[model samples]
Target chain A: MADVKDVDWDAVMADSRFQSLRRKKTIFLWVLMVFSMTYYFVLPLGAAYFPHVFQIKIWGVLNVGLLFALSQFVVAWAVAFCYERRASGQFDVLAKEIVVAFHQQEPRR
Target chain B: MRASRAWSSVILCVISVLVALMPNVALADATVIGGEWRALTLTVFAAVIGLTIYVTYRSASHVKSAADFYAASGSISGLQNGWAIAGDYLSAASFLGIAGLIALNGYDGFMYSVGFLVAYVTVLLVIAEPCRNIGQYTLADILAYRNDPKLSRIFGALSVITVSTFYLTAQMVGGGVLVKTLIGIDYEVSVIAVGVLMLGYVIFGGMVATTWVQIIKATLLVIASIVLVMLVWVPYGFSLPDFMADVVGDPKVQARVAALLGDSSTVMTPSELGQRFLEPGLLYKMPVDQISLAMALVFGTAGLPHILMRFFTVHDAQQARKSVLWAMAIIGGFYVLTLILGFGAAHLVGPAAISAVDAGGNMAAPLLAQYLGGGRDSFWGNFMLAFVSAVAFATIVAVVAGLVLAAASAMAHDLYVGVLRAGRQVSSGQQVAAARVATLIVGAMAILIGIAAKGQNVAVLVGLAFAVAASANFPCILLTLYWRRANTAGMVAGMVVGTLVAVGLTLVSPNLTYPLQKIAAANKVLDAEQAKRTAIEAVLQNPWPQSESLIVKARAEQVALDKAIRLAQADIKKYEGQSRSFMGLKEPLISLKNPGVISIPAGFLAAILASLWIRDERARAKWSELYVRQNTGMGISKSVSH
Candidate 1:
């Protein structure tokens, strides 16, 4: 690895592709974080405040509460899958390009 | 080769000592296992130990540098590391505690399982890739990359040791208790055995052996859970409808459900009992408690040192990301099965029988295994019990090893090398040696504390560990990574305030003892009256006093006894609320058991306000370097193979 001072981090930070990568990654992560946090909190709040709503049975012994709890597992997995796809498919490529471009500019280092 | 020989000798010494101690300890026990099963379970436990030793020796030969000791030389694949992460995260608490909690509390218990899995989402999306890109060995490396190195390493090591030690002791104590109850091992002996085994893994095998141990344990645990779930469903003909029918319609289940409800006047029907059990608010009546605990679970995991260290074991940021995804899948699936296991125990084993063996219901999984295999007298039942017991033992040992490794790294790598010998030339050989010594010390201390805290409530320690991680470590790491203005002052202040507020709130919260002076005074008066009644009853029981004076005295004593009984009853009625709040207040100072809801905001605020209040040119100038490195993985350290 090259020294920190030799890398010209400021130039790399100002690059358009790197900027785009950060923009897209941050926005996608923020959305998922917000959605998941809201969905996670709802389990405790909904179950505690509205017990009767959760108590309404849907199938045999399975109720809305149980279904909602189980759905959290699905939503969490889905979020992970979506992020993996986006990150590996797009973000990783942009990151690789940015690294390669930087290396080309500082070939001596 | 010489070191390998020395390790083998040490291993042999430890094994011989344990073997010598077992017979004396076994004689002292009210052994839980009977007849041939006792020897069978012991043999299985021996096999587990033998396998650990074999793996440790294999990795011991490969551990040649600090990287190998601290991060397994970064050769572990993404999928393998994921299993290791799951192994570290899924402690005995998750396997046994949650299952037992669900069996007893129904929906409320299952709520804990969901939060535990969803916690990984926060780790995956927010923390994983960036952490992998920036950090070399510990979380301190990330902070030191941009901020003040000495300050960051010091506070980082402090928080890591704090979180890991508390968690370590809790797991050790839990292991001792579980082993004693399930397999009838002495508590002290079990704690020492586990502690020694953990040290062997961390000191000799280092991270490589620890990772493999975790992977194998995780596989075994998952397979065992699947088998248990299948057994629970097989009797229902592998149909969900049939299972649900029996769960709600079975007379035995209804009886156990009613017993849990604790309402004796009206006998609730099977369907009604099932509905009540399926609904929430049974164990946690307070909504705030529920929210507070959920917040801690979701955010706290991202800050765990052991979990974060797993990222560095992978080759690159992409592998790190992949590993988190794999962990989420395994952990999520495991939790989902816990729901079935919980209800299965309730229906098949009955809460009555489950709690009868262990009041905490921690033995639910093992007991369920026994029933599923056949019954107590059956051969398969005994085998399943032994198998589950061995798995629980492996789970505890694997988790403690991960924790000891994390704490040892903080001490040796972060504290000794980064802070104590700052800017000094240190050899990799010295670093590895220091880590081994630290592991031995930390592991031993945990064993001692675990034994001393034999019957203490472990829930408080687990809660405090999470609270500290979420409030102290999480904020500092997050801000250092993203906030450009995060300076030395801000980082230090954030950690100090975060840790203080978390611990302070927990101390004042209802999780600890509240002053009940009034109840104590009331109890004093009640005791006096009861003692008077007992004295009068003793005098009245003697019929040999035939004299007129003696008869008169006996009659007077009987009259006094009546008054004493009346007074004692009145006093008991007056102070019926012994557990009422201090100073006659309706609630304690802080009602929330978990302090995340308040302390987490406090931690973040402390960091932001301090950063905005103070300015540092050096920190501001380094932000771009960290940012470029974090986003694009530039200039990150490559894995050391030699």
Candidate 2:
């Protein structure tokens, strides 16, 4: 194994494929994180401050708070599924291309 | 005495078998052994344990190399690894504690489940694939990869050991409580038994055995939960409303609720009962603690060594990503059913019965199982109890094994091989041996501490473990992967500050400190009363007194009694007010039961601020390479058999 300092990281970072992949993943993760955190924080905050509203029954025997809590499970799965599809379909292709380009530029000794 | 002894033996046999079938039960008495349930429970328990041990024996042969020992040679597929991850993550705390909490406190308990399940999204989006792409064996590998390996190794090892040990203690305590309650054994004995079994699995079978055990346990727990839900649902015509109505209408349950509201004569309407159960504020009277707990749980999952290590068992980063989704699906479904189980126990068994069994309500699930089966002495009742208990037991064993493996790897692989040997060319065989020895040492420490911590609430310790993990380990991992400027000094400072603040706050938090003060106050009151009684006795010359002197003494005694009663009432009021405060302070230094709200940001700030001062160009340059590799999975090590 060679020292990591020897790798041409500047060239790799400059590659359009690497930059594109990084941007897509970062944006997707941040959006999903903010959405999930907001959704989660709302339950306790709502129950604490506006509990009477949360206690109002939306469906037979199901209240606003219970519905809100249960929706989080579905939302979490949907986000994960979307991320998986995006990664395997689009990101993987770009990643493979970058790997191939790097190897071609500096062939392993 | 002879009759009672005979009855006890009969109960023991059934309990032992049920103990084999299920690992936890909160209350056991003479009535538990009255019928065919005992025989059925025993038989099922035996079969479960037999199957578990057999799986361990079968997997032992494949663990011939260090890679195999640490990661099952990355032979596990995504789906299998997902179930294994669930098995590893869901401990007695989730299965018993959450359900019990919901039974006692309504909506507040279910909040814990929501926080726990949502945490996986963070794992799926940010940590999973990147962690899998970067390292092997333990979390320390990734932390040390780009920076100074020696310093990273030291900090990583310390954090991993600290988090794992805290988690281990919680699981061991749960195990002891389960064994004592179900099998009627001493708490110390139960702790030692669980510790020894955990050591056996790690020392002999390694990750192969551990993974299989987890997979089996997870499957069993899910199945048991589904069965319990069905049983509870069927009688209520599969309508949640009907089931809840029955719970609200039960005379005993109604009485319990009236007592909770401080009005014995109160008769609550159906809507009011529903409102109380569905809304918060029953358990978390102060709302800040609720949000703080959620913060700890959400960020905490990313830092737990055992959970993080599971990603390595799969083949690649893609599988790692897939595994998190699969885990979320299974775990999410199981939590949904916990509502049914919790409410069912509260309705069918009643709060009085639950408290009689265990004040913590940890036995709600198992007791509910027995009720659903056909009451305590019926064949179905015994069988259901045994099965649930077996699954709960498996839950404890699987979680503890994972924690021990993570801690031992940190001790042997990171500290012994990486730092002490300076990454020397030690044989894989020798490394495997060192890990086994470390497992024994770690296991022994957990057992001793667990014995010492007997009867302490399991929930508090579990929460503290999450806070520590989130504060200390989460920031270092995130910064190391993302920020280019983060150096050895920043990582060390973040870990030290985060760990000290979290642990220090927990020690002084109302949960631990207030209880000690209350006990001390009670002892002082008792001593004062004893001294007063002695003085009164010494003042009297003879056993019998004249009427005039007796009347005079009685009047004085009445005055003292009134004074004492007033003092006691004041003490009770003061203690209630100070229950959530620190050291008789008007307001607590750490207001929240969980310290994550403050500690997590403290960690990130410390890391970022410290990094700004120390510029390491080498580490900064290394970041691009780490980022490229982390994103693209290029030049990452493929799983190789030694």
Candidate 3:
């Protein structure tokens, strides 16, 4: 546990780095969340609303609907990969720095 | 007392297994159930039981503390946790049910699998990290952090218990039917055995045992599915087009399908039939219900108490994120295989044989496994069938263990410790004891419900559970983390109203029974007529002492009854059409089979409006603390080191 009591909450809250990390993460996650949600809804929506369009044969047995549904697995994997990259690379580093700063200043208080 | 109860249940499981193995036991009428494969299937089942007993014993010694019991001492790594998550998440519903659905209803079943996989994206991006950072043991911990602990714990415990119990019942019922059909065990015995095993896991081993059970089950399930897929693919030269073409051109498949459609006279060309099967409208005719079900799955997965509770088992936010990523890969890959499994069953097992065994097509996967191993008479065929059945049975037991543990945690940690004790400090031993006792109660309730729901469609219950989770649980958890203005009243209103509306809509909706009730009524009458015919035919077989006139009259009556029975069966098929609603109504009160589309938004809106409508200063005051901790992972407990 990070010794929540000794660290100064008001100061940490005002830290510019902490503020930036939160903003960046919030925007990145929401955008990803929104995009994934929209991309997913398209499968059910297209299959239901435009049956003829989705029925267009793309291959011997594969139709547009089947292909679209299969593509979702790829898309979900891609989204997870992207989020993992960003989270591990950028978000965790920034959050770790904030944690370090608070802990380093705790003894001086 | 609790220990004795647990022992008795285990004894019951042993007795039932013994009885099921006895020679010349009364078998079900279904040809699929028991024949020559009983030894192999029971051996496989015994192996799984042996594994559970060993794992639970090992975990029991380590489960001395509350943390050990609840979060497996936070020792599970990302990879193992990922597999466990897959095991817990992929119920027999996904493995057996969806594959069967795909085999029976082509494109629509694949659509369901898509939503299931894509739902993980929501979990990864939103729920995983924050939940791990802010919560401990139960989901209620997260809420209690920023709101009134008592109020939040109470509601949280209530929703968790409700969702988990609803989900547990579905698994228990599915387990019962699946076991009975595959091995010819009685449904009551199957339900009791499953309940006993699940209770043994949760009561003795807690999360650690549950996690390992899930991990082992998941590995077995995935490997079995891959092997099945490969076996299926080999016959078609590993070519997709070849498989599709064969599936379409196979005369047996077409005839069986025609029979299933109840229109053998009107035969479409193979290509046209292929087009119809490959298209999207076979099972789900309603676009609205599709959208509703899709929404529920994508949102509801994030809110499942069992899934969410997994995060607490990991050490930190980063591990939690990694676990979800791992889960996504395994689950996504598994779902892709389901397409082949489904289509393969349709091609190999034939729809006629599949439905002849179980109407819901639940037997498609297992039967397909048998066929790919060379048909029912072959040794390899029965061995492969028993393997898949055992893996599926393990799948159900693992999932139910997770659910029972989650509910017990809510009952013990959230309700008893947090609310009843008013957040007083409880000894670790006492907490563990409470959880064990809670497991017994919950397991008993599930067993009774599973037995009572025998032969009834519990698929609706699964849908209802998802809708409730999405509507009631998701909105509150999401708002608590994001919305600074979210207050206790708003959260309360959201849960109460969300649960009410979702459940209310489902009760009135076509999901309860529209055509199903009407068809079931017709079936009852048809069954009686068929039974009467069978009796007369039996009497006619021994007519040496009877008069010729009587024998001739009985033969004539049997012939007439056959025609009457066929007509009655066709009458039942007529009610299969979805255009007609329940209770003689032209349309259902709510046409959407899943209530997510309406109820999910209602939950969010209620929370938002209630928050905006009412003010709570204390909640707003604590937002900064929660915000920092959630984002930075500060104050999160380390892995318990005992």
Number of the top DockQ candidate = 1
Tens-place lDDT per residue, model 2, B410-521, is 9999999999998479898899999988898898899888988886655667787898789878888888888778877788888888898888777666665563356456
Predicted candidate 1 versus true structure: per-residue lDDT over B239-270, tens digit per residue: 76567666666544555455455424134444
Candidate 2: segments with Cα more than 4 A from true spot: A1-7, A105-109, B1-39, B263-271, B513-589, B638-642
C-alpha positional error of residue B106 in candidate 2 after TM-score superposition, expressed in Å:
1.2
Q: Model 1, B608: alpha-carbon shift in Å? A: 0.8
Task: Count clashes in each candidate, considering only residues at least 3 apart in sequence or on different chains.
Answer: 0, 9, 0
Docking class of 2: medium
DockQ of each: 0.73, 0.55, 0.71
lDDT by residue (B426-486, candidate 3, tens digit) is 8889999998998898889999999888867678889989999999899999999888899
Which is the winner by DockQ between candidate 1 and candidate 3?
A: 1
Per-candidate RMSD, Å:
8.6, 9.9, 7.5
User: Relative to the true structure, how large is the alpha-carbon lDDT of every model?
Assistant: 0.82, 0.77, 0.83
